[model samples]
Target: MGRKHLEEITLLRGLAIIGVVAIHSHPPPLSLGFLGLNKLYIEELSKFSVPLFIFISGLVLTFRYTGETIVYTDFLKRRFEKILIPYLAWSGIYLLYRYLYKSETFSLFAIAKKFLIGSAYFHLYYVFLILQFYLLFPLFLRLIQRFKNRKTALLSIAAALNLIFIAFYESTLLIPERLPRRIFIFWIFYFILGAVIGGDLKNNKRSAADKISYKLLIPLFAASLIYLLAPAGLPLGSKLDVFWLMKKTFFYAALFILLSYKLASESNFPTHNIALKPITSLGKYSLGIYLAHLIILEPLSTIILNRNLLFILTLSIAWFFTKTVSNLPYGHLLVGKINNSDT
Candidate 1:
């Protein structure tokens, strides 16, 4: 039988996309003191968004195909169709936008370089990063299977390596300055953790309740809150510090995964409530929103003075565009797969 649909995962996706938008929407200046601190808090908390998405990718992929024989070619073809094609389309769109408005010149070689490196837009690097993971997933799967009995050890090792890489990346010691941030090693721990959890959920048929507990939740919540309220000088520097930002985000992402699972397991949790409809809908069209939002936000920023209003308008426009395009012939090639059942 097919695995049950995960409404909680969709809910988490909705939350993640909101976080993504929050990070991009520039808030008031730090001179505003309390208001600035509030905005900074939200933005800092949202740092978990990207890592959470990466974790979900690993989880959903493993959950669906753990014990099955995956035809590697077919897998690549599907992933290419769903992800890479849209990435290329968006790259071209962004390139044209820059050439027309920003007076940026692009030669054939430059365009090709942008496509290869995901430099067409700031957000496109994530697509490039995910594509890298997709390409190496088969090898990762085999490795996971080879040591299936020692998942905890595998996760521990991956986390240690990830932390070490982050430290090296920050110090610029062994890692080359030219090495791109899109490298998989920088983010592999979250994916591997997700894969291990996915495998357990599949092999053991464990309920969401079994995957989380109050003992876990209480401590994670305390840690996250403490991290949020603590002054910038304490270890994790200002938000501008990439190393500390990523380190904290990794912690937040793990906490979120557990929290989401716990919420989904509750008997009275209202997945179909009217208040939640928009969030779940946003989750449904998250990829399209991710691709389209920056394009909309850049143009709209000139007209919308209020940052909050700009955020809402950008999300609304992107959602409308995504929903409209998803119905057109071969729209997935432009925006991404929109069908809720596909996930």
Candidate 2:
């Protein structure tokens, strides 16, 4: 079979990038009035954003073949070259900024420690998690592909395991707090969703009836509604139960995957134009955009916390600058060399 064209993947990449941008554009729960509404918005949107990213990562890898048998050494080398190298370089850049200008003084060891811990910034946490996912992906893909004919069973198992992990294991492990990076337990499901969906899409034996079910729009709308209601539904009067919220979010992630797949499967989306040029470029240099946006977002958020005009202006200006620099010849190379080589 021929390799799938790269156009849709580019668009999906754009969606993933925009989701991240949108997530950071919204303020945290504590900062918003009618905390429940804004919190629901942030929690729901942000939940979909990173999982979409992880799903895209796995989807891309599952579809592309390098010809040679997958080897952990080569995998690690390429993964590190793509993700970690850029991360480390950018961490140094940010560290230097903090050292010279910000109130904080950065020691070399402190810089190294922060980089390793992924606590240097909010987005860097993703960098650290992707590194972990990259190392395990080959094995993960191998195991997932084994269930090609048993997809329903496989999905059931994944759902069950996810519930168990979320309810039972995560707190005991305290993985996110203790680890070098923030470990989002739900993202593992996203990664698997990407792998499984991509696998089914690639499989030849599946009939047209199967594809029709994939087209239903109900799941997307339902998931969005559930996500919106969760905070309001479980308020402190009624403290919004975190456990129940997470459980619903897991369902939300699945619906998101369905939505993403449906969107990607479409041939009608706009594929050209000037206004979209920046976003399309963002898709191409997403890793750079992902890492570089935070450099602007954090401070901008501080400066424009409650001012609506300033907030919109900040997001627009930052998006422009981020897209501009991400597309530059050497700028792309520098960050691309480290965090993403897929483009």
Candidate 3:
């Protein structure tokens, strides 16, 4: 059976998924007067997609492992069975579609190699990275739980490692191929940070003050930093790597959780509102929406983005399709833990 329903958890999951979709949609510029400026803002904000998902996954993992000692092997197996397997399955399905529809040529041997090594394109990188994080989280968790004084030290190490990885890759240090050490370097920090925060929360009281510090100040600081530094036509190089982004994105994710909690606690953002209910409803099946929408967006962009009205119309159609598919049984297979019956 699932744990007690946390509206805050699901709502945040939904919000994070939509943030990801925004990244994918790469929506046309809003009329923010400065057209170029607005497009830049939307694009940068969309980059939060991966960071947001990682942050939430970290938070959830930490919450699960708190104070309870378990075998690392078992933990890894369970996580892989649930998340990695599904990712591989979906990746294969998408890969086949790409081969057939996009005229992307691939030998059978290459397909096997890409699948086994996770060297495919688009969001498959996240699938591979998450698996790496799951493998590393246990040892990382043990360290944080053992050495309470090492939080700042740990953060610095993560920062330094992030910088090293970025310098080499020109992107975040990812396992660009099937190299184990390189991949390990790329993803370990987020896993550790999540586990540390989870462990910390066990004794760390959440007073109003702590909430303000972590939830509000941290995100505001991150936003200010991004605004100051990230400008138009930025290539999102190593500076946007997992380690560097996590420091701020973790704050943003924490803020999202805190805000959602407070909002739910006070019934601030009510489902009673007619307009938001649809968005939230879509959010309910966000994983389904997420996994399926990419198949639509890539092709639609080639056609619809040429015209503003067509783009809007295409988005509406895509949203309708996503919502429809999410309502189906297959949708449950996408989000992992969510139960569609509740809706």
Top-lDDT candidate index: 1
Q: What TM-score goes with each of the models? A: 0.89, 0.79, 0.71
The deviation in Å at residue 322 for candidate 2 is 4.3
The parts of candidate 3 lying over 4 Å away from their true place are 1-7, 27-36, 167-184, 187-189, 207-230, 233-284, 306-335, 339-343
Over the stretch 121-211, how does candidate 3's per-residue lDDT look in tens digits?
4656666766777777776666766666666677567757754654565433553433532365654554455455545555453422234
TM-score ranking, best first: 1, 2, 3
What order do candidates take by lDDT, descending? 1, 2, 3
Global lDDT of model 2: 0.61
| Cα lDDT of model 1 by residue, 218-300, tens digit | 78867976765464433334323333235555666667766765675454344576878898788888999999899999889
Q: Which is the leading candidate under TM-score?
A: 1
Better of 1 and 3 by TM-score: 1
In candidate 3, how many clashes are counted? 0
Overall local distance difference test of candidate 3:
0.55
Provide the overall lDDT of each model, using Cα atoms, as 2-decimal numbers.
0.75, 0.61, 0.55
TM-score: which is higher, 2 or 3? 2
Which stretches of candidate 2 lie above 4 Å from their native place? 31-36, 39-43, 66-68, 100-102, 106-109, 169-181, 184-186, 202-220, 233-245, 268-270, 273-279, 302-319, 326-329, 337-343
